[model samples]
Target chain A: MPKQVDHEERRAAIVSALWKLAGERGLDRVSLRDTAREAGMSLGQLQHYFATRDDMLVFAMDFISKRTTERVTARVLALDERTPEAILRMCVAEMLPLDDRKRQGSRMSISFYVEALDNERLLSHAREGSRKLLDFFEQQLREAQDRDEIPADRDPRREGMIIMSVVDGLTSYCHLGLHTAEEALAMAMRHLDTLFGAAHETKR
Target chain B: MPKQVDHEERRAAIVSALWKLAGERGLDRVSLRDTAREAGMSLGQLQHYFATRDDMLVFAMDFISKRTTERVTARVLALDERTPEAILRMCVAEMLPLDDRKRQGSRMSISFYVEALDNERLLSHAREGSRKLLDFFEQQLREAQDRDEIPADRDPRREGMIIMSVVDGLTSYCHLGLHTAEEALAMAMRHLDTLFGAAHETKR
Candidate 1:
């Protein structure tokens, strides 16, 4: 159990190194040798955890995606008012690149997104993650509808997809510096306000 | 004059080759040598047109952006009813990867977008294009508001940005095959419906 814990720690360190390199330079510029140097390990040691560049990328993406889910879940659980509408807003906010750490996460996700466009393994991995998020959003929308917070006629699945797209688009613009993170979050709030009915003001 | 024309043609041919390679293998995998070979030319010939990989990428991006603008313009002009709603829908449809050629274009753009996250020159180039597009969208929205087609209280610039973001998010999803082109277009139309008011049914 101790050795297993050590292995996990080392892998986490390498992935952290990968993120550092990817954040400063785009993900495409990352190489195993450079990552190993950044992690203060030999290439051979890095290879023990990741056999190839793709292997390293896939592992890094999984790590970040899981971490993001955990972070978002924790934030939602700690919220004072966890109405369906509030929960959805919290999730959307978490998805946006609102600060430095979140921005780096967004950058890494965007890189993987582009890579996923052509790589089957990465594409499936991304799709699975997206599917899970969409299902969760749909569930929240359904809950809102049940509580009469949103129109009953609205399709939860479609609404969830639109919310996802808006958040994604805002994230892209934020990364490009075309819109500030604050501006993006405001836009997302506006969209949610329209969806949840103008009468339901956010308690936050 | 013929020599100048030939020079332009050769550059076009090279860019075309780059697109083909990029569309199939992703842009990050493309190299000057590979592009030259794909174009049925030599490395020297390719280097003559593009001194560096960045030079090639910038040129190719410019070429593609110009072509996309011209095509979208043509489609908009051909529309029978050029209302703000109609025009915006047409532009959004053109932006989506609804077919083979467009899918390839989106793939290339996505790759460039990732690159632009780190490269200043490319970032500026991308921002310039996005600014122009946003301005165009805002103008259309302003006209709509003036005509009382959309609510006058809505901010034209902000609405334009939201439209752009929704379309962009949909485009990314479409490329990933998470949503078919048709599904993305439907989702975009729904957003427009909500924006333009429920009474304004799309002519198309």
Candidate 2:
């Protein structure tokens, strides 16, 4: 059991190194040899954990997605005001690159997304993640509707997708420096205002 | 003058070949040599048109941007109903990957976007294009407001940015097949409905 725990720790360390390199240079530029060097390990040792570069890439992507979900869940649980509006805001905010850690994560994710466009395996994985996120968004919107927080006529599924797109679009622009993180957040809040009605504005 | 025209044509041909390869494989996987082969030319011949790979990339990006603009312009010009709402609809529609040719273009553009994130020169070029597009969107919203098409209090600049983000987000999902092109179009139209008021829905 102790040996297995050490093995997991080493893999985690290697994935961390991969993210660091991927963040600095785009993911496409990352090589197993370079990642080995970044992780302060021999190439053979790194290969022991990940048989192929694709394996490493897949593992790294999976790791990031899980970590992001855990972080968002923890944040949501700690919120004093857990209204549907508050939950939706927190979820969207978590999606954006508001801080240094998130910015790096965003960069790596975008890089992975581009790579996935051409790779079927990666693309399928991405689609699965997207579906789950979309479902979660829809659930939140449905809850808001139940509480009469939003209009009865609103289609929760479509509205969830639109919110997803908005956050994604804002995140991309934020990375390019076309819009500041604060500006993106304001735009998202305004969108929520339109959805939940301006009269129910949540206090900061 | 004839020699200059031939030179320009050769460069255009190379860019076309690059796009074909980029559409098949991601842009990161494209190489000058492979592009030359794809163009049915020697590497030497290709090098005569482009001094370096970066030079070729910049030229290809610039060419795509100009071509897309020309296509969108031609499309809008052909519109019989030239209201601000109609124009906005057309513009957003053009951004979507509703067909094969556009799917290819979107794939290339996205690949270039990921590459640009790590390349300073490419990022600056991308930023310039984004700024211009955002400005155009703002101008359209302002025109809509002037005609009393949308609410008077709507901030054109912010609305423009939001619209930009929505379109971008939808485009990305369309490529990933998370949303069908038609569904994406409907979502965008719904967004327009909110902005222009449902009563003012333009007759298709």
**Candidate number achieving the greatest DockQ relative to the actual structure:** 2
TM-scores of the models, in the given order?
0.90, 0.92
Which runs in model 1 stand beyond 4 Å of their true positions?
Answer: A1-5, A42-44, A51-53, A198-204, B1-5, B42-48, B198-204
Query: Candidate 1 at A45: error in angstroms?
Result: 3.9
Query: Where does candidate 2 chain A have its weakest 10-residue lDDT segment?
Result: A195-204
Please give, for residues B1-204, the per-residue lDDT of candidate 1 as tens digits: 444448889999999999888877778788999999999998998899899888999999899999988998898899999999899999999998899888878878888888777788888888888988999999999999988888665788888988998899888887776889999999998788777873343532
lDDT of 2 by residue, A129-159 (tens): 8999999999989999998888776789888
lDDT of each: 0.86, 0.87
Tell me the lDDT of candidate 2.
0.87
lDDT of 2 by residue, B1-204 (tens): 454447778889999999988877668889999999998899999999887888899999899899999999999999999888899999999998899888888888887788788788888889989999999999999998988888776789888988988888988888777989899999998888877873254632
Q: Over all chains combined, what TM-score does candidate 2 have?
A: 0.92
Q: What is the TM-score of chain B in candidate 1?
A: 0.91
